[model samples]
Target: MARAPTTADAFNAVAEPRRRDILNYLALAERSVSEIVDALEMEQPSVSKHLRVLKDVGLVDARREGRQMLYRVNALAIRPLWEWTTTFERLWRHQLVKVKENAEKKTNL
Candidate 1:
């Protein structure tokens, strides 16, 4: 099957690692492109490209602040991603329980 374009949806857009990093950074607070580049240790152009993809998918919001454009995560747009992942929460909890049980057993041995 052909791969969907990055702009197809939030999932496709965030599939890229750099875009995920951008989202994580923006989650803390809105920031300028230069700040993202500096904090993430990525080139300005690369950060810009990832930001564009995120914006296209509605996962990010950008606005001008004086001479700089600030970017932030759109929590509403990310809701679907969060909801989808949460469907697997039970599985994750089960795995964690198994790990804890194994560790306790080892300690008791």
Candidate 2:
């Protein structure tokens, strides 16, 4: 049996440039696995592997439509990423303020 991918695993998987491209495409609309493969010009198996991870992490949803399995972004999973990132936004702003102050001091010297 395979262990299910966690949220960290899902985010890490998409840290790959190509995998991020896949998510960007899915962001526009739901797609069949074939559509993703053709759009990315990548191997079907590789695309499938990424999709499996996405699904496991609740970042993507999959459903069988007749002979095809369709996939779409999971809004819930992406929501947490937004919530998590917002915390860092405040921290970065504070750091930037300090950096700007240091830069001004150096320029005066």
The C-alpha RMSD of each candidate to the native structure, in angstroms, is 2.0, 3.5
Residue pairs in clash, model 1: none
Supply the global lDDT for candidate 1: 0.93
Per-candidate local distance difference test: 0.93, 0.82
lDDT of 2 by residue, 1-109 (tens): 6654334555665566876777889999999999999998999999998888787777789999998899998777777667879989989999999999999999999
Residue-level lDDT tens digits of model 1 in 1-109: 7899999999899789988888899999999999999999999999999899999989989999999999999989989989999999999999999999999999999
lDDT of 1 at 56: 91
10 residues in a row with least lDDT, candidate 1: 14-23
Candidate 2: Cα lDDT at 14 = 58
Predicted model with the maximum TM-score: 1
